[model samples]
Structure formats: C-alpha cells, structure tokens
Target chain A: MKTKQELKEILDFIARYATYQLGSGVHTSRAVRNSRRIGEALGVDVQLSSFQKSTVLTVLDPESGEALTRVAAIPALPISFERNSDLSALSWEALDEGLALDEIRRRYRTLVDKPRMDPIFTLAVVGLANASFCRLFGGDWTAVGIVFTATLVGYAVKQRMQAHGVNHFLLFAGSAFVASLCATAALRFDCTAEIALATSPLFLVPGVPLINGVIDIVEGHVLMGVSRLVNAMLLIVCIAAGLSVTLLMVKDSLL
Target chain B: MIVTDMLLDGLFAAVAAIGFGAISDPPMRALPRIALLAAAGHALRFCLMRHAGADIASASFVAALVIGMGSLWLGRGIRCPMTCLYIPALLPMVPGVYAYRTVFSLIMFLQSLDRADGGVRYMQQFFLNATVSLSVIALLAAGATLPIFVFRRRAFSMTRRK
Candidate 1:
C-alpha cells in the first residue's frame, strides 16, 4: 500500500538510524540485525555493508523488486550503552507491535535526545574508579587519595579539551601527562608512587574499542576489526606518550 | 586475612565498575548488574592469582570467560545487549601496571641506548612488559568472546527472541 517515494523516505530513515547505531559503537552484527529488523517491520528487505566510518544500505521493495540505496557517513560518537539499548528496544517495539514510520522516528529522536550524565559527575566517578583500581592493586590510602585527585584533574582537563574540540591524540597525551605528574605527589609524600602513577591513567583505557575489535574479527568483519584494533593501538600509544613525559621529568625520583 | 583481602578487592572492583558504568551511561536499571559482574570477575581473578598460583594471563582469561558468559545470560534475562554488562565487567581486569611498565621500560631502553649492557637489560624489560600486557589483553578478549562463538545459536536466539 506504500508508494515508491514513501518507501524511499522510509528507507532513508532506516539507513540513517543504522548508521547512527554503527557510529555509536554497537557491534557490527547487532547493527545489521537491528536494521534488518526495522526493515522487516516496515515490509522491506534491507542489506547493509559497514566500514569503520561509513555504512551503505539497500532497501528492496518486496512486491515490485525495486530498490533504494542510501549511504551515510557516520561520525564517531562516544560509546553509550544506554543509546544502544534504547535503539535495540525501539527496533523490537517496531517489529513486535507493527509501529508506523512516524512513531518510530519520534521514539528514536527522544531516545537520542535524552540527557546524558552530567560531565562533572562522570569525571568524579572516573576518578573514584581509578583510585579504587590503585587500592585493588595494593596502594595504601595515601596513594588512593593521590590517584583520585590526579584522575579528577586529568579527566577535567580532558573534558575541557574535548569541549574545545582539540585533537584526540593530544587530549590523551596531555591528560596522561597531567595525571602522571599529579600522581608523582605520592612520591613526595612517601606514598606508593608506582601504584599511583600506574593507576591514574586507568580511566583512559579504550575498553569498548578493544572489546568491539575482537568481537568484530571473531564475527568475520575483518576490515572493521583491524581498523578498530589499529585505532585502539594508536590511543594506547598516545597514553604511553603522555605518561612518558611525566616519567622522564621525574626520572630521578621514579626510576 | 586472605578472605578479607579478596572481599576488599571485589568491593573495589565493583566500585570501579559502577564508576565506569556511570561514565558510559548505560540504562539506570543495569548499573547494579554491571557492578555485580565486575565484582564477580575481579574476585575470581584474585582468587586464582592468590590461591591457585595461576599467572596473570590465565587468571584474567578465566575471569573474563566467566564474565562473558554471565553477561550473555544476564543480558538475556534483562533484555539488554551483552555489551551493556560485559565491557564494564572487564574493565577491572585491564593490566594497568603492565601497560605502564611497558611504556616505562620502552623509555628506559631508549635512554640507555648509549650503554650497551644497560640498553640490553632495558630492551629485555621492554619486550617482557609489552608481551605480558598485550597477551593479557588478547586473552581477556578471546576468553570473553569464546562463549559467543561456542553457543552461537543460543546467543543469537537470546538476542532475537521477542
């Protein structure tokens, strides 16, 4: 009962939604599956090909066999498991309840537009987490306090740099430098400098990319997997570079 | 004393995972599950290292495997993606010391390039640290993902079921 133009518009929405999901760090298989579910719910057949930064989709009209292909350039977004969960739930609702295109679009908008956790709260928790890591690794109370402060300052710097749109590598390196430098205060106070230094930057490890990269390779998305791995490695190198600056500055005390 | 330390470790790991889950902004309802998974994984790894004398790599592998399977099961039960639980759970096992030592050794190696014997020692340290760090990470990933491959159909059905 849908006209070709109407179908094309629906396909466009599907393509955009899938691209957003992919960019948001859903594993490739899940992205494809979710999109396909959306397509089926709308009475279309969907084909998806995704790379690290872009996705191409084709929506085929079952009755007429005509197809509409759309390509979306997906800008990388910070990983948010809530967004992934909400989007997945949206697709399920569409399929299970036979929701129309307008309703789906409205839900998607609300889901993405939901307010994120406050940046200051995020920084505090990250600091607390890194400090706990220091304790778990055997640091004493002094070291934990130092690491908590170091991560707090470092993460605040990172947030500021990111807000100001600095390059990511610089952000990583700069934050690492500030954090490790602050961690050296433990050495001055006769606390465990090694543990503090080591745990201060724990907040910056690229957990999502590392896990997603392995999952992608295991699931046969070789190119995306490799790309993600390489990206993660680069981030690691940036983190190391940042930490090294601090170590070199305090080599007499640290080494 | 040992039991108390293990409990403390689990507690810290859970706290850290809660922080990570908060940062990632998973659904509010899933935070407790994430903390539980993280604590469980960290406790298992701590026990293996302390009691069984397993190396870091093996201990982390086992812990990650447990967490992975737990994530899949929990995800299904809660109707959320496995990633929502597993990523935060695995964060505590990340080899922070090994990673930092790798970079430190590399820097030491570079600086000692003028001293043949010192350079060799630093180079060996660098290689050792890098290998340990990388291997732990690889093992963690492999162990976490093995269940998905082994139970592919079941995992798929869990995700796909309405």
Candidate 2:
C-alpha cells in the first residue's frame, strides 16, 4: 500500500545506511545483514551490493512489485568502534521496537554526531603502545624510551597530515619515515638499536583492513575482500619503503 | 620465574591494547574488557611458546581463539559488537618481526639477483618469513572469527536488548 515516493525514500535511506556501515569499517557481510535487518523492520526487502568505493542498494516493495535502487559512494570515514556498535544496535532496536523510519534516522544522527577521542590523547596512548610493542620484542628500556618519543613525533605528523587530507599511503609512509628516523637515535647508544628501528612503526600496520579482508573473503564477499587486502598490502609496502629509506641512511652505523 | 614473566607479559599487553585500542575509538566502557582480553590472550601465547614449545603461528591461533570466545561473552555484557572488543585486543599479538623480516628478505633477494648463492639464500628467507607472516595473520583472523561462525545467533545479537 506504500506509494512510489515512500519506496524511493526508503531506498535512499537504505543506501546511506549500508554505505555508512561500509565506510565505518564493517566487513561487507555485517553491513548487508544490518541493512537487511533494518529493511525488514521497515517492511521492505533490501538487496545490497557493496564495493570498496560504493554500494548499490535496491529496495523492493514486495506488496506492490515496485523496486528502487540507489548507488551511493562510500565516504572515507575514520574507524570508530563506538559508531559501529551503536549502528548495529540501532538496527536491532528498530527491529525489536518496530521503530519508524524517522525515529531510526534521529537515533542514527545522534550516534554519528557523538564526539570521538581527542587526537592528542590517542597520539600519546599510541606512542605508549608502540613502545610496549618494542618491549615485547625484547628491546631494552633505552630502546623503549627511544621508540616512545619516535612514535609521538611520527603520530603527531600523521595526525596533522591526515587533517590536511593527505593521501593515506603517503601519510603512512611519511609517518613511518619520521618514526624510524627518530628511532635511529638508538644507534648512537648501547641499546637494542635494531629492535627500536623494527618496532617504531608498528602502529601503522593496517590491522583492521587486513583482518576484515580475510573475514570478508571467508564469508564469500570476495570482491570487497580482495580490494581491502590489496589496500592493506599497499599500506604495508608503504611503511616498509619508508623504513627502508631510514635504514639506507643509517645502514653503516646500524651494524 | 615463569609466573613473573607471564605477569609482565600480561601487564605490558594490557597497556598495549588500551593504547592501540584507543586508535580505533572503541567505547570507553569497553577499554577495561579489551585490556583483560589482551592480557589473557597474550600471556597465554607467551606461556605456550615459552613452555610448550609451540610455534608462533600455532600459539597465536590458540590465543586468538581465547580472545574470540572472551569477546563473545564479554561483548554481551556491554551490548557492543564482538568485533569492537576482539580486534583491538588482537592487535598486540600481530607478528611485526616476521612481517619486517619478510620485507627485508624480499629487498635483499631483489638486490642480490645477480649473485646466485646470495639470491637463493635471500629468496629462501623471503619465502620463509612471508609464509610465516601470512599464516600468522590469516590464522589470527580465522581463530577470532571461528567463535562467531559457531555462535552466529549470539554474536550478531549481542547488541540486542536481553
């Protein structure tokens, strides 16, 4: 009994919902499931095809045999587990409460608009984490201290460059270069110089994308899986290239 | 002595998880659980490797399984998705050394292409390190997702009101 305009609006909302989930770093399978769940709550059937750069969503009015599809580009958003969790919960809430579209939209807006962790706090914590990574690799206190300072400086640069909308690969490379170069200060001391250099850029390893790629492939979303894996591999290569530059400059002194 | 080492391992891992987990901006309430999962999982891997003579990849798989299960149960309490808890906890166990060695060996292999013996040695090193790194990474993902695969209803419904 829904009008064509109503189906179109639902299609549009589904497109944004799916694309935002994809952009927020969920694997394709989860995005599809959550989107379909929301569609079910709204009394429509949604068929979603997700890609690395975009998603195509089709909303079918089973009662009337009318369908509308929309292709929306997935925006590049920072990973936020809080958003991911809340959005997934929102889908469930819609289903459980039989919530209306307007209520869902209102909740979604509030969820996404929540403030994220401060960049300075995240930077400091990541520096401490990378330093601990050095210790796990058997670095001495001196090397750990070196890595801590190196990561702080490098992550600050990454944060600043990211704010300016730099290419991600270049941002990763620039950060790694700055971090490993700073870590080479261990070469001047009697500490675990190699470990310091090795672990300085550990923070830049694309863990989410790499793991999510495998999850996607295993779950049969092969196209997006391969794209994500390729992207993660490229980032790893960029990190290595950055470190190699530092190593080349300090090769003799390192040994 | 062994207990002390494991304790230190867990302590460092908790700190590492909290720090790295923050990067992805997990819910503030999830931090303590993430730390606990990371500590328990990393410490278990350390114990298995140091005491049980297990290889790195296998130890990681076991540890990741533990983390996966822990996250599944813990996530329900907080009404968060299991991925939000487990992924950051798994970060501390990533094989940084193996990955670095793989890239380093690849570089050496390319550089020594004209020298047959040197090239052969570096090529062998490259494959070995790359295989280990890939296996560990793949295994970690497999182990973590296995719980979800088994308990699909619970995993997907953790955010639902009980």
Candidate 3:
C-alpha cells in the first residue's frame, strides 16, 4: 500500500495533468495564468523550469540558476522554409495527500463528457428558439415549425456524414441551408402555416452564445467570454455564407 | 399528463445537474448522490411554493440550500469553486426563458410595420414578464443559503461545547 504522502503526491500530479490537458483544449492562456496564481497563493516552494525544443536547453530558476526540468513539447518538421516552434511545459507536480487511481479515472471520464450533450447549453439553444419563434409568430408558429423540423433533418444529415470525415464548417452550413430552403419552399408552395416552425432552427443558430459572449465582454471577462462569443459568431457567419449563395441565385420576384 | 410533464422536467433536470456537477471535482459517487439531493430539493421547493407561497427566488434558494447541507450528511461529497452543476442544471428553471421572451417580444415589435403603439405594448409585456421571473429565481437562489448558515451555526455551537 502507498503511504499517505505518496498518495497525496500522485493525486496532486493527476489533478495538475488533467487540468493542463483540458486547459490546453479550451483557453490555454487563462489556464496558465490561473495555475501561476494558484501556485503563488499556495506558496508552493518547488522550482519551476522550461526548455526550448533542443537537446541541451533548460530554463533555470532566476535566483538559483538550477535547471528544474528538461522539456521537448514540439518537434520540428523539415519540410517548408517557414517553420515555427511552440513552447509547452512538459510537466509539473503537486502533492495531493489522499488521491486514488480509481478517483482519477472517474474524474477524467466526467470531465471529458461535459462538452458533449451539456443540458444547459442545449436547453439554452432550445429556449432561445422557442422564445424567438413565439415572438415572431406569436400564436402563429407556422413557418418557424417548418424551419425547426428542417433543422432537425439537417442535424441528422450532418451526424451521418460526420463519420466520413466531413468538414464541420461545411456540414453546419449545409444544414442551415437545408433549413432555410425548407422554410422558403413551404412559404412559396402550400402556404402552410408552418413557416415559423421551419425558420425556428435557423434562428436557433449561435445567437444565444454570441449574446452571452457580448455580455461576458461587458462584464469584463473580456477575453474569456468574447472568444466564446467569437466562435459562436463564426459558426453563424459560415451558415450565412451558405444561405446567401442560395438566396442570391433566386430572382428578386420570388417574394 | 400534466404530472408527467412536471416529473419528466424534474427528472431531466436532475440527470443533467448531477452529470454536470460531477464534472469539476469529486468524481466518484457524485451523480447518484447528487440526483437524490436534487430530488429532495425539488420536493422541498414544491412544498414551500404550494403551502407557504414563499417567493419564487426564495423557494429555489432554500431548496438549493437543503441540497447543499444534505451533502455533508451524505459524506465526502464533491467541493468545487464555481456553482458547478447546481447553477447550470438549475438554469432551466432559472427564468432564463422569461428573459428570452422579453427580448424576442421587443424584436417583433421593432420588425412590425404596424402602429408604434402596439410595438411598445409588446416591449412592455416582455420586460414585465422577465422582471417577475428573474426576481423569483434570484430570490430563491439567495434563500438557498439558509442551510449553509444553519450548518455553520451548528458547527460553531459544537466547537464551543468541545
């Protein structure tokens, strides 16, 4: 059995590693800043070090000049004349007094699952759609209903093609186009009171996250929130690009 | 059928909450346990709302507090920096819907080619509904802190006795 001190050390290491990998995936800068702050606040006394992507380079402590750790985060490819290197911390350690392997595995799994099917995010999208649809066609959800159904179909198509390594930007644009086309067709053809339903999905696109990002900026989490907002807006821009192609192709008299 | 809707909503909310809560910390045994706590919270909130007509925000807060305090009794539950699953999962019931409606309604008015007066009326409608709903959610979240107070007081008293 591992001693209490040994176990804590392992736990601390796992915690730091998990946070590092996940942070790199999302906001790396924020993670780096937060980690540095946490270390300062906790008064952790371990020496910190960094290394360039070469065999003999190491960052020594400013005061002691002792090399802390050797690192090789990025490797160079000798292809193009224009090549660049990225810096990364190879690893760090913390002493968690009571950590377990099973616990680490369990936490890792949960952390991985969050970006997928997170209910609040989905509900937020749905709620915004419901609200906007009701407002636009209050007691008149015809065309929006068509849009909603079309969007679902579009989503289904995207999912199916996803396994074949389809470009996500193109997939999303195609889905939005299909939704818009469905609404447009319903309006021009049967005059079914389903336009609201059809257009509903189009409206569901990144508006909420965009607005949220803006709110985050206003609240001064400028980088953290706005980057999220920008990503959402870019998705919309991709969809709009897809939609404009179809819209411009048709005659002005289609109204 | 109405009961089914309410139950489904609560159940979905619970599943999502527990799942989300387990995200940041204390990975082991968080979901099933958090689910139970969420149920108890909802039940308490339901009773409070029905019998005492407690303010909506206050009711939500009290219920959340119940869940938080009960977590201690459950033994070695997760501790996290942010609100974790509670806020996000609780968000469905957060009156965000009302806030959304408020904005959407105003947009419709602005889009309309009709009388300006009608547009203003919709703008008012959305804002009023949003205010009431948001107020209720905020109050309940606040009231939920009562359990924390009670827990702290009990701890203090016990320490004094010790």
Candidate 4:
C-alpha cells in the first residue's frame, strides 16, 4: 500500500534512470529492460515510449491503481561506457537488494560524479590508434608518421571545437578536412599517399551510432533506430564532404 | 610468413581497440578484455580472408559472432554489459575503405550522369561498394546482437549479484 507521494517518487526515479541510459548511448531495448527491472523492484509496472529526443514513461501502481506518466528529454551526454555499465549494475542492485530510493539515488550520484579519463590522454591514444589504422591499411612507415602527426593536430582541433560548443556536423567536417589535408603531405614522398589520406579520418567513423542503430531496429525500436542511423549517415556525409575537398585538391592522386 | 602477418594483425587491432575504447570511457578493468576480444576477432578475420578465401562481409560476420560470444562470457566477470566490451572491439573491423569508396563513387556517379559510359562505370562502382558496405555493417550488428537473444537470461543478468 504505497502512498501517492511514493508512487510519484518511484516514477521520477525510473524516468531519470532511463533517460540517463538513453543519453549515454544505451540502445532502446536495454534501457527498457533496466528501467523495468527497477520498477519491478519498486512494485510498479513501467512502460516506455522512447524516441530520439524524448522518452515518455508511464508508471502504474498496481495496488493503488494510481498511474503517473512523465516525459523526460534525454540529455546530450558524451558516450560513457563506464557510466552505462555502472548504471546497469545499479539497476540490478536495486532489484536484488530491494534498496530504498534514497540509497539508490546516492549510489547513482557517486557513479555519475566519478571522474572520467583525462582528455589529453585520450587524445594521445586516439592519435596512436589512427596511426595503427593507417598501418593496417598498408601505408608505409612514412605514411604512418604523417597520419600520426595529422591525427594529433586534427583531434586537438576537434577537442577544442567540441569544448567550445561547435555543432557536431561542422566539427566532423572541420576535423576531417584538417586531418586529410595534413595527410596529403605524403604525396611528395612517392609512398602510400592515398592510403594515408584514406586512413587519416578513420577515427571519426561513428561506429557506435552505426552499430546501435542496427541493434535498435533489430530489437524492434524502429523509430529510434531510424533516427540514429540517419544521424550517423549525416555524419558520414560530412566526413566525405571534408575528404572531397582534399580529393579535389589532389586530383592527380585519384584515391 | 602467414603467422607473422596474423600476429601483426592482432597486435595492431589490440592497440586500436584500447585507444578507441578509451573514447567511450569504459571502466578501467574492462580495457584488457576489450583488447583480447579485438585481437581474437580481427586476427580470425584476417586468417579467413587471407587463407580461407572468405569475402569481407562473411568474414566480418564470423568475427563478430566470435566477439559476441566472447563478450557474453567476459562481461560477467567484470559485471559490465556485453555492449561495452564488444562495441570498441568491433570498431577496427569496420569497413572504412568500403564506406568511403561508396561515398566517393556516389559522387562520381552523380557527376558523370551526362556522359553515358562514364556514368555507367561510376554507377557500377557505386553500387558494388555500397552493397559491400551495407552488408558488412548489417551482418556485424546481427552477429554481435544474436548471442544476447539466444542466451537471454545470462545476457540480461550479467550484472546481477550472487
């Protein structure tokens, strides 16, 4: 026999829980599963109608017949697998321990407040990774060196622009243009100039959205799936637009 | 010679996975698992393509299947969802060349629409590249997510406390 206040609190918690997962790049099916798991522990039924921008979640208190529905706009958080994993674990803890909302919320706060990997370190690693990608594509050592330098410069620009709140499409285009333009230095060496150009922008491939979109569609979340795929496609086009500029400049390379 | 190539393939993929996996901010304990998964999947794909005569699409499907199963088992130890482990591992295998070629050829196709023979050649290239890219992408997603459906209870409860 839960009170109305209790029902509302539960509903709010569930909504916040699901929206964070959505924003942090969990697919639709998993978000639903985790939210419902929490709701079940709280002795309520949860239904979510999730879209690209918002999620409409309804909570039914079966005993009191008091239902509450709320729509939460998903935040635009950077994709954090650590956050996603901890949040999912939190849901399981709520279910397994039947923890009260205050305790659950406290744990959630701690998890979210945890510090992320240093951006400088991440940038360095990504530069190295993109260089490895160039090598994997059969670029010569000279081409790899060019790509390494190019990725360092381009990713730095991307990080700075992203921090300044640049639109993502523009960010991607600018980064690709910068990276590929730097990679074109390989042309003078008579080495794998084309391979360097091709691989310089591999770091911006939108892998998560591309894969998550397909998963959502396969799991029957059609609307969100389509929206994600469309977003990824646009980013790919932006990448190509940037590359095309370089291609136009290096027409003789014919890559 | 073949063994050296495969080892190089695995080594590069592991490095790539660690770097890309960092971008997503995964838990520190999960990086090693991501590296191992990427190495195994990418190396196997290399072998299949180089020695077994498998096309990129089919080889990718098999590699992703291996990654899916590996993550299902590995994720439980770390109390993380399989998605966290497999997504970065699969990044190196993305058909970057095919994806870009598709876009490059599409632009070429559109530009040459006035010249019949040129248009025909570009159109053919565009479709060929697009088909390969889309098929590989679709298969990778399907193969990775299939294990979750097959082992629903285990997949969903990987984070559960005993």
Candidate 5:
C-alpha cells in the first residue's frame, strides 16, 4: 500500500531508532531483535551490524526487492533503562496493533524526548547508595555520614563535568579525587576513614559495561565485547589515578 | 551476632540497589524488584562467605547466578528487559574494597620501585589484590549470564511474544 519513497523514509526512521537503542546501551542482540521486530511489523526485513561507535541497518521490501540501507553515527548518551523499556513496549504495540508509520514515528519522538530524572534526585540517591555501601562494609554511623557527604560532593562534580561535556576519563578521575579527598574528613574526626574512602567511590564503578562486555563475548560478539571491556578497564584506571592523588597527599597521616 | 550482621547487610544492599536504580533511571515499577534481587544476592554471598568459608570469587559467582536467574524470571513477569532488573541489583556485589586495594598497592609498588624489601611486598600485595578483584568481576559476569544461554529458547520466546 505504500510507495517506495515512503517505505524508504520509514526504514530510515527505523534505522535511527535502532541506532539510538544501541547507543543507549542495550546489548547488540537485543537491539537487533527489537529493530527486526519493528521492521517486520511494517512488512520489511531488517539486517543490523553494530560496531564500537556506529551501527548499520538495512531494510528490504520483500515484494519489490527494494532495499534501503542506513549507517548512523551514534553519539554517546547516558544509559536510561526507562527509555529502553518504553521503546521495547512501543515496538510490541506496533507489532500487535499494526500501527501506522506516522503514529509510530510520533510515539518514538515522544519516547526520546521524555524528561530525565531530576539531577538533584540522582545526586542524592548515588550519595545514599555509596553511604549504604560503607555501612554494608561495616562502617559506623560517623563513617556513613562522612561517606554520604563525600559521595554527594563527588557525584555533584561528576554531574557538573558531564553537563559541561568534559572528557569521560577526566570526569571520572576528578570525581574520584574529590570523593577520596572529602572522605579524609572521616579520618580527621576519628571515624573509619578506610571504609569511607573505599566506599565513597563505589558509585563510579562501571558495573553495566563490565557485565555487558562479558555477555557480548559469551554471545559471540567478540569485537564489541573486547572494546567494551577495554573501555571499562581504562575508566577503572582513571578512577585509580584520581584516588591515588588523595592517597599520596595524606599518606603519612593515614599510615 | 553473625545472623544480625547478615540481616543488616541484606537491608543495606536493598537500600543501595534502590538508590542505584533511581540513579540509572529505570522505570519506577522496577525499583522494588531490583531491591529484592540485590538483597537476596548480597545475603546469599554473605552467608557463603561467613558460613561455608567460600572465597570472594566463588561467593560472588553463586550470588550473581541467583540474581541473573531471578532477573530473567522477573523480567518476563514484568515484560521488560532482564537488564532493567539485573544491573542495578548486581551493584552491591562489585567488590569495591578489593579494587581500591589493588590500585593502592600498585601505586605503592611503583613509588617504592628502587627499594628491595618493601617494593617486593607491595608488588605481591598488588598482584594478590588485582587477581582477586579481576576474578570476582569475571565470575560475576559469567555466572549471571550462564542462565540466559541455558534457557535461550525460553528467553527468546518470552521476548518475542506480543
């Protein structure tokens, strides 16, 4: 029922949607699966290839044997599980109800533009989580208080650096340095400085990427897995570099 | 005293998972499940370490396996991706202390490079800490994802359904 040009436009939008999902940190197979589901719903066949920083998607009209291929360079975006869930749900709806292309496009646009969580709320939760880690590791009330404040300050710095579009490595390093430095206050106050220092930067650990890297390798996406693992290792090194400065400065006192 | 400690640890793990779930911006509906999974995993690990004398790597592996299976089941029940449930839940088991110690010892080793006795000790400590940290991370990933592979057909069918 649709002309070739209109179908091409739909395929392009689907490719962009797939690229966005990939960029937002969904696993390769899931991204591919979701994109194919949407394409099939609209009566097309989809093929996807993902690399470290970009994705290639092709949609084919089986009846006419016409194909449209799109290569999108995905700029990094902060991972949001909320958006991933919403998009997946949207694709399912399209498949079940046979939604029109215009309606699907409008829904996709709204999903992408959904407001993110409040920055203040994010800072507070990260701080609380880190502080909880301190307690779980046996820090006393005073140490928990110190770690809470330290994480709050550190996470705020991280948020600010991200807002300014600073380099990722530097942002992590700076946040770690600030966190460890502030955690020293626990020592000054006779609290458990060791626990505070160890836990304050727990929030900065890239748990998702580390897990995703292993999953990718296990699932046979070796190149993507290796890249993700290397990136995570580099970030860990940056975090250590930042924490090392604080440790060196306060070496004598702590020792 | 041990029982109380384990209970407290589980409670903290749940709270930490909730906070992390919020920070990651998962759907509000998913937070409770994340908290429950985290608490369950952390408690399981703590029990293994305290009662069975399991090493950090083995304990983390078992705990992560539990969390992974739980995530799959829960994700299917809730009709969302398994990752939305698992990543935040697994945060509590990340071995932060070992990682920090690995870095600290490595730095000390580098600084004492010219020294004979202390440098060797620092170097040994660095290797020990790094080995433990890396092993735990590796095991965590392997154990958590093993179920997905084992139950591949079920996983695929569940996700593919309308």
Candidate 6:
C-alpha cells in the first residue's frame, strides 16, 4: 500500500533511531522487531535485516519474512553523533516534502523493513559497558568518569571502526585501559570506595549496544547475536587483562 | 553485590531497560516514560520474586508481553515503537547474573566432587543453592508480569502507555 520512497523514509528513521541502541550493545534484532511493530502501525507487513556493512538493508513482507524483490539503502549517518547529541538536524517535517501522505506511508513500511548496516554503534556500546565494570562494582567516581572518557573515545572513533574489526577491539581496549588507568589511581588515592562510588554513573553512561544485543538475541539470530555478544565479551576480557596489568604495576604504591 | 541486593537489584534491572531503550533510539524522548515503566515493572517483579521465585523469568517475560499490549492500548497518538519502549524497561531485569553464577558455581562443584575432597559436598550444596536461586529469579520475573497480563486488556485503555 505504501510507496518505495515512503518506505525509504521510514527505514531511514529506523536506522537513525537504531544508532542509539547500537552504542549500548543492546543488539539490533530489537530494530527488526521494532520495524515490524512500526509496519503494523502503518498497516503494512514488513521485516528488516541489516548487512555486515553499509546502509543497505534486506527487507521482506512479514507474511513470509522473505526479502522484497528490491534492496533499499538508507544513509548510515548516526554512527558519528556527538556525545549527548541533539537530533534537531533530522527534522520530521523534512520528509514531508514532495510526497503525498498515502505514498509516504507505503514507502515508510518498506523503509522500516530494511536491516541496519553499521556496527559502530554496537562496538562503541560494549566499550562503554566494559569501562563501567569498576563503577558498577561500587568503585569510586574516577571509575565513572572513565566511562565518559571511553564514551568520547568510542564516539569519536566508532564511524571508522567495523564489526569484528581490529579497530573496534582496539577502541574498546583503549577505553578500558584509560578508564581503569584512572580508576587504579582513584582506588589508591581518591580515598574510600564509597566516596568514589558516585563516580560509577560516569561508567554507567552509554546504551546503544546493550539494546542491540538484547534485540538480536530476543529476535532469535543466535549466531550473529552471539558473535556480537562474544566480541563484546572479548573486549571485557581484554579490559580485565589491561586492568590486571595496571594492578600488577601499581600493587606496591598503595599500602 | 549487596549494594545491588534484592529490590535494588530489581530496580536496577529497570535501569538496564532504560539503557537499552536509549541505545536503540538515541534521541528518543520517551526515556522518562521508560523510567516510569521501569518502576512499575520493578514493583511487579518484586511482588512475584518475593512470592513464586522460579517463575521470575516467566513473570518478567509477561511484563514484556504486557508492555506490548499496553503500547498498543495506550500509546495511540505519540508514535512510539512498542518494542523499543517495552524492551528497555525490561532490560535491567534479565537474569544474566544468575545464569553466570549458576554455571560458574556448577563448574566449581563438579570440580570439587571429582577431586573427592571434603569440599566437594559443600560445593555440591552451593551448586544446588545457585541453581535454586537461578530458578527463583526466573520465576519471580515471570510471575511479576502476571498482574500486567490480567489487567492488560483494561490496563491499556486509560492513558499513553509509553
């Protein structure tokens, strides 16, 4: 019932919204299910699947959950949004131009059915979560602050990173080291653990990947979801490795 | 871990849900709505966890299901994705920690029992305890969503269910 162009707009909106979850490691299948929900709202039956890269998506009608005859592309721009961003640049009214309401609705359905193509949001989220471990454990403010640092670094580099890519791992590792590097000092010098516990919020910061991972697993993409999760788990392992090294290096300093 | 004990643990689960929502739609304005849902969800999960124990997963899953029903019922005008709204409010409650502890402690128990040390039996007891705890957590989650399910038909009619 919807036009191809309207579907494109809807998919673009889905992609824009998805970046938020990707940064938290929540998973993307939520996006798929989410798209389906949106499709239902528009009175259409559609499903979306993301490729390993690019904004290209494989869309299908929900009755069969198979790919539509054609592939559509949405600009994958949110991978590089600034820390605590405002999306005023992406005005809803902007999409209203040159398209009729019924036509817009049709395209929107098709668009919402497209899969997300980027993993930077996913990669960055895992980094933020790993950096939060110390804070979540009731550590100091420094632990929390470091989460912010990781967020900045991850946000800065996510666009350039890839799924299961070397830089993705590096960004996560770097964030872990930097966050814990500061945390190590705080653990020794910043006084009691409770005094620093408030800082955990800094670490608790960020959310995209957490959402993506959950969505993926819940939607039943066992391997792809697990791989993303495993990749995140590896980042945590590396963080622990880095933290252990920090602990080993600084062991004699505190007592 | 005591800091995250019981009710707080449950409350934080809702936080995870919000975090999940924020992740999917970064600029989503419905975060505060999620906050409220998290509170409602935590309260429901608390009642169920406090009672049925093992059904916690079923309860929470029901919470998620009710959330879907609620969205369709109440969020008619605002244009929110129901899954995006509902899932995050439930994110903080997933039983990963229990699963982690169960599997980890189980491995240790099996190791101890295999070595035939006196600690083996103790480890076995711990394994049982962990398993029971995991079941309890799941049941609580499942049961908590019960009220939502019953009330969901009428529950959705009142207001914006974001």
**TM per model?**
0.97, 0.97, 0.44, 0.97, 0.96, 0.47
Error of 3 at B4 (Å): 11
User: lDDT by residue for model 6 over A64-116, one digit each (tens)?
Assistant: 33333334433333332111122111112223243343554455445444444
The C-alpha local distance difference test score for the whole of candidate 2 amounts to 0.91
Worst 10 residues of 1 chain A by lDDT: A1-10
lDDT of 1 at A188: 85
Off by over 4 Å in 3: A1-93, A97-255, B1-12, B15-29, B67-75, B78-84, B96-100, B111-113, B132-162
Candidate 4 CAPRI category? medium
Q: Which candidate wins on DockQ?
A: 2
- DockQ of candidate 4 against the true complex: 0.76
Q: Each model's C-alpha lDDT?
A: 0.87, 0.91, 0.42, 0.89, 0.85, 0.44
Model 5 lDDT per residue over A175-217, tens place? 9999999998987887778888888877888877888888888
Give lDDT tens digits, candidate 2, residues B16-84.
Answer: 999998889999999999999999999999999999999999999999999999999999999988889
Error of model 3, residue B107, in angstroms: 3.9
Candidate 6 chain A worst ten-residue window by lDDT: A81-90
Tens-place lDDT per residue, model 2, A135-249, is 9989999999999999999999999999999999999999999999999999999999988998998899888898889889988999999999999999999999998888778
DockQ of 3: 0.04
lDDT of 6 by residue, B44-86 (tens): 6555656567365556665555554554443344444343355
Instruction: Name model 5 segments beyond 4 Å from true.
Output: B157-162
Candidate 6 CAPRI assessment class:
incorrect
Worst 10 residues of 5 chain A by lDDT: A22-31
- Specify the CAPRI tier of model 2: high
Question: For residues A1-255, what per-residue lDDT tens digits would candidate 3 score against the true structure?
Answer: 334453344335433442443222212232333334233323332322222122211222334333333332423221110000001111111113222344544554554444333334433444333333333332244443454555455555555665566776787677666655554555464543333322333432442234334334444456646565567657756665555544444324232
Those runs of model 1 whose alpha carbons end farther than 4 Å from true positions after fitting are B157-162
Off by over 4 Å in 4: B109-116
As for DockQ, the candidate ahead, 3 or 4, is 4
Candidate order (lDDT):
2, 4, 1, 5, 6, 3
